[model samples]
Target: MRKLNWILALVLMVPAVVLAAGKTELTWYGHSAFKLTTPSGKVLLIDPWITNPANKNGKEDLAKLDKADLVLITHGHFDHVGNSVEIAKKTGAKLVSTFDLGKALATYGGYPEKQMGFDTQGNFGGELNLLDGEVKITFIPAIHSSTVVAPEGSADKDIHDGGNPGGFVVSVKNGPTIYHTGDTDVFSDMALIAKFDKVDVMLACIGGHFTMGPKRAAEAVRLVHPGMVVPMHYGTFPVLDGTPEAFGTALKKEGAKARLRVMKIGETLTF
Candidate 1:
């Protein structure tokens, strides 16, 4: 009886140990939106453009989220900022963005100014240590214009100009360093970012009309040479018609080291 009891105890303990050692998961919410859950159980949402046509079921999905720890905004575009304030209010998540964006949200968008923290501010080339220990986020340059559009369809450009559109290299505790490139055109700065940050996974935008097309974005991916590449910011509107199939073909032709991962609207990829 003692021998049988010891074997049963060992068998149950093995599954518990494996569950305790949980790996980080990457869930795609579509249209430049992704949720990263670290091993320590911190949730980070990046450029969440929920409610767009590309999202398919974004607005409905937002209501189901009860815990969002940090929200990172690359620019002040309406699509990217969609549901940010609402999500923050609902979940008590901290917003990570430029100083001007935070100010604009508080002054114009009526966000609670009290929850805003000093860690919210990060410029191009700046690094921020997340509240979750050992996870770090570095803001890199993106060659794109960023200005808030008013309800009347007029551009609200200012001297500050909402800083600049950018990307993030997020380093999780025991997981890979994931890079998310916000809306940008092909620029040499991407090469610099690649050299400085050894990205494991890259979320690059590949839409033609507004951002870099398939060909140029493939070049950018080659320059970065991430382990895996995921495409975003396309197929949402009539203007943005670039497809993932084209991107995959180009990547193959270029002999890029990165593997292309084309996810569905609400797919989750565990890293």
Candidate 2:
């Protein structure tokens, strides 16, 4: 009886150990903003527009964000760079972006100069091993434009070149591989992403006018072949009329294999 009891106890403990070791948290704060917490407790914020119009509790959420290890910005647009300076100042988080965009943000956008450096900045076709190899970030190309405008009433309000717009492929140690497709339309080269690493989750923009709509975004899903897909950058303004329901329908029409995950504003999920 003692031998049998010991075996059962070990079997139960195995599952709990595995679950605890592999858990990763993901939070969506509306628009294209996301907070990703790694299994090792590292925090990464991407396009942290925490106060976007789509989020009802944006202010509260922003106030509570006292910890951030890295702030990843994909472009120079006002919407994409939303509240990044404030968050970086408050949390002392390092900035991850292209060199030109980093320079523009620091010089005109009031982002601290000491927080960003070559160690964290890179351009397309380059990859950086960050956080002692806990995370690997690759700069991916995006078919879009980028321009940074200085804050209101600043000494210099001139629009600065924000370098090329791009996305990121973030691989978390012992966690999932997330591909954030910054503001861009469906392009053929996206198929190349799967050749390097299989994408576990894809944060895609589906808003029309500024970015691709439902049908084109579905095509993007087909190209990348992510395990799961999350639609973002929609319904913030009247111009961005894309809907998750429409995106689902388009995914079905395209025969994409990825599971559609439509996260609500200010929702968190563990993987």
Candidate 3:
């Protein structure tokens, strides 16, 4: 039965090989916008402001997104909201956000009311296994403000309170655990994130005037202790003057072990 034993050994190796082949592709679309492609081919967009000032191919890129499974919004700001409403209508992506923000977007903004429900919405300290167990998302607190403004040139120009600001810790099956620190300043409790799960990638905002600057972001990086860090939400306007170089310098000063990954707009990285 030596031949039978050899066949069984080969069969056992197949699953390991398949698991190793699985990869997650992460694409940044300028500012705080990111697209996550899971190993199972599911698509998730976070604050997808694809048409922001930084991306030269913003229009083309936005047009190409035909199949988004989920859209995760960090807060209610215009920049963070970005082109989510348009993308949702185009792809029928379910909105994953706080209950308050979901209501505001559906009421005042253009998010599909039918697609947003209890299956997707959540608040801080809550975790949900989604995408048929391909992903786990947990909401984390962020120190920021959120407001939903009417579209430009609207007659009423009504402003509404969005909800509490927060971030996301997304754990993908057979992939990396990514932390999107949706516009927030450095806080001491950020260290607790690593206590719950190991963060493979951290998408952090480094712009000074609005969110925390480079130095504080570096400290945040140190607290979370992710494998890599990608800076975002900077250089979009004259007020947002934080630079990647400054962030890198501050990271070095903080003695953080995470690798500094500076992504050019529209660039994708596989993990």
Candidate 4:
């Protein structure tokens, strides 16, 4: 009887350990950006452009960052790469950007050039796994531009277009796969991405004047058909004056298959 009791206790402990080792969480930092936390507590930050007037001291927030394992940059734009160098250095996270962007960071931004993990190179349709296959992030296509400016406001000759622009499809360990569309207009290929990746959560950019507005974004959500759709890239600048309320209304009107979710700044979502 004693042996049987001990065996049952071990069995319970095994599942607890597995569950702890298999859990994952995603946090939205707004503007087509997110942080993925693996079950083992490894953190992967995608397009961490976490600074804007709306952030309320968001620049200072970088100093408090901890456990940043990797930093993924969607493009070479200033907003997207705003604090990439600082966060990567402070948290000792690898900077994952295009080969050109990584080189620019090392040459221009004084980042650790050797630590960059170049995933995109002016094209798309590539995937990389991190943390011993605990998570996988795929680089997809976006129809935008890329640029990296030098400290002196001079353009770095080494700067490459790094494709037009892009986003990522992140697959967490035993968790939902999230697709982040980084500053893209509505395109027919979005539907193809949905068919291919089967995204679970989509962090879409809906701020007009640069990215898609509410109407086109609604079409994007419908085409992607994620389990949940969260609007981003709005209320940051005057040009991007879109609101989640408008996006939600459009989603409903369009009869999007996915649920529309609105999150406050610094909020997190778990699957």
- What overall lDDT goes with each candidate model? 0.81, 0.94, 0.95, 0.77
* Highest-scoring model, lDDT: 3
Off by over 4 Å in 1: 1-20, 149-160
Q: TM-score: which is higher, 3 or 4?
A: 3
lDDT of 2 by residue, 1-271 (tens): 9999999999989966874687788999999999999887889999999999989899999999999999999999999999899999999999999998899889888889999999999999899999889899999999999999887678885888999999999998888999999999999999999999899999999988999999999999999999999999999999999999999999999999999999988888888
> What is the TM-score of each predicted model, taking all chains together?
0.87, 0.92, 0.94, 0.87
Which digits, one per residue and each the tens of the lDDT, describe model 3 over residues 1-271? 9999999999999988987698999999999999999987999999999999988899999999999999999999999999998999999999999999999999888788999999999999999899999999999999999998766666758889899999999999999999999999999999999999999999999999989999999999999999999999999988999999999999999999999999998899998
Rank ordering of all candidates by TM-score, starting from the highest: 3, 2, 4, 1
TM-score of 3: 0.94
Best by TM-score: 3
Sorted by lDDT, highest first, which candidate order results?
A: 3, 2, 1, 4
- Per-residue alpha-carbon lDDT of candidate 4 for residues 160-235, written as tens digits (9 for 90 to 100): 3433578888887777788888878888888888767779989889888888999889998988889998888898
For model 1, residues 211-230, the per-residue Cα lDDT tens digits are 99888899999888899999
**Root-mean-square deviation per candidate:** 3.8, 3.5, 2.1, 3.0
Query: Candidates 1 and 2: which is better by TM-score?
Result: 2
What overall lDDT, based on C-alpha atoms, would model 1 receive against the true structure? 0.81
